[model samples]
Target: MRVRNRKGAPEMMAANTQYVVENPEAFKGKWAEKFGNDHPIHIEVGSGKGAFITGMAERHPDINYIAIDMQLTVLSYALDKVLEMNLSNVQLLHVDGSSLTNYFADGEVALVYLNFSDPWPKTRHEKRRLTYKDFLKTYETILVPHGKVHFKTDNRGLFEYSLASMSQYGMTLQQVWLDLHADTDFAGKNVMTEYEAKFSSKGQVIYRVEAQF
Candidate 1:
């Protein structure tokens, strides 16, 4: 699905330099200083809107959250929500997920979230998948020892592919849910993204997995 580009999105992002990082690469290995504390940093790669990342920051005050997206228009939406909530623990980064290593040093990030990422279903595009082995290696590089990745998606094929990719990369799967909403025990533990809420409302099954590297 193509996101409608919003007018003034670039200006909006430019005005909010405090919450929107202008030069993320300059802060490599120094994210704790950027957050002004050593709180565990959790990032949502391909964070579509402000929903999941901002919600997580609100729930976990001790954890710093960074929302990364390549689309400036989409990131502007997230910026609006962060400012509306006056969340000090959240930051927005306008960068591609594939360049994560350029912005973070080894053991800098504690956790990662891949929510409803593009499947890149074409056989020739498999390497573009977030769960691809090379991408997994990048995640592994920035993640702390035993750091985990939490992934959610409505697409069955992508979920299956991600599961296999993570397993092949020697990641330990901590939890797997074929129908997350059907699990009564998972209530209150899951934070629904904009896409997750929309798809799940249509009676679509949500798949989730937690894998540790």
Candidate 2:
């Protein structure tokens, strides 16, 4: 497992701080116990270099944060931030987002964030897309009955694909923005990912939504 040490990311990383974990399996079943609180757990899947999740963790101490990514190199940078910020309420895990059920008990998570996930647009790679129905089913199992998936992306095809998948999984899209930065409340409310900041800075039109299963 090659961990990503993200010294190559642009200056935009300066503002986005987060915690990263190297070997996440060591902390299994300890998230609730370690946080030592019963706050709603909001998890960010595919959390890159710890930007968005970390920022959100810092902002919302009342909410327990768990950021999962398979890439260890980049994840370490995130963990470094947790140590820097001394956040007792945040946790990081290195795992496949597609294999969500392995980590959580049924109805354990309150919210799930999917930001700039791999589009996996090749027709044959549909199964690998994180928002595919199979993955949604996995998420539904771990998420509470009221749990929701908050997704953001610059890929139009994946965004549309996700919309269809969400509906197929018996989810209602609650809030959606075709152009996320159009003075929309979503842009104000969302913690932008590292790739999101780069895409948005380049005037990319990001599509986003909240879906309940």
Candidate 3:
């Protein structure tokens, strides 16, 4: 997941500011107003390259989407994809996931997505994982009652750790698919991220889970 520094990445992001919100904090508690609709807001943390978010937005026009990624280089690519699609229901933000609550009000989000997020393999960095207990607490603060987190990963170790962490945190685990593509109920409806497509093509088992608070 090492991203190469693309020259003029910042400038490119700035040029595409129409789709990329420069100050996401300004939209706190007013995301529906910002979208000019009362549609539910769904956010994708670490939305690398925008494939999944953009696709979801396209397919589900009734829902508004905000794709957040910290790296300007990677986010710029996502911005380009949004612009290319001319999608009205989707927006991009260059921000860290750990500080998500700062830009979103309590219960402002209906659902959050974590697709192929960095696993943070080292035991010392467990807290940095997106599905860690601390991060799940942060998500709980922003989500409404019964709000859910839909997570998918290609790594088994990370998936197992996330299942245990979410359960331990007292979140309600609803649905789980140890091999998503092999699950008939979800495979057809599931939208593939860039990583998911690549990994699944190589016969990797994708794990998915839904947890509610």
Candidate 4:
């Protein structure tokens, strides 16, 4: 999805400085200190437009959430939602996923959410996929021992590739749902992202999985 450049997006993003972390690298090892609690931290990679992460933070106030995205335009939209909701447990970061380890310490993250990430649907671009082994290694480095990754996607090719990639990286997979909306167990429990709601409404099946390392 190509995002149209929002005029004055950088200024808008800067104005919401309270919700967006200015120096995430400075809080690398002491994330809990920033949150003023010892609650477990959950991070969502590519948290475009903030629907899922904000909803999760609102639902699970006991857990801390950091929503990361690389684009300022998209991230500003997410930050706006968080501010509108007056959510204290959620923070937004305009950072690339490849440099995630720089903003988090080893064993600092409890759970990771990868919701509807780019498929990068090409043989040569496999390495760019978030679920690729290299990115999985990065996740493992920042994740606590036994930390789990909750992933959802409407793209069949990406979901299938992710399952195989995670398995190859020695992650124990569980709670596999090939058709998430049709699953009674997740009814009313699943928080849909903007992309997710759009895709599922059109009769596309959503695939989800939990992988623990």
lDDT of each: 0.94, 0.80, 0.91, 0.93
Clashes of 4: 0
Backbone clashes in model 2, listed as residue pairs? 3-72, 3-73, 4-73, 4-74, 19-78, 19-79, 20-78, 20-79
**Tens-place lDDT digits, model 4, residues 1-213:** 657888988888788777789899999999898899999999999999999999999999999999999888888889778988999998889889899999999999999999999999999999999999999999999999989999999999999999999999999998789999998877879999999999999999999999999
For candidate 1, the 10 contiguous residues with the lowest summed lDDT are 184-193
Q: What is the Cα-based lDDT of residue 135 in candidate 4?
A: 95
The order of the candidates by lDDT, greatest first, is 1, 4, 3, 2
Regions more than 4 Å wrong, model 4: none
Residue by residue across 1-213, what tens digits does model 3's lDDT show?
869988998898888766889989999999988899999999999999899998999899999999999888888878778888889999888999999999999999999999998899999999899999889988999998889999999999999999999999998899999888988867568999999999999999999999998
lDDT string, candidate 1, 42-140, tens digits = 999999887999999998999999999999989999998999999999999999999999999999999999999999999999999999999999999
lDDT of 2 at 174: 97
TM-score on alpha carbons, each prediction: 0.98, 0.87, 0.97, 0.98
On the 0 to 100 scale, the lDDT of residue 77 in model 4 is 83
Flag the better candidate by lDDT, 1 or 2.
1
lDDT of candidate 1 vs native? 0.94
Q: Distance (Å) between predicted and true CA of 197, model 3?
A: 0.7
How many steric overlaps does candidate 2 have? 8
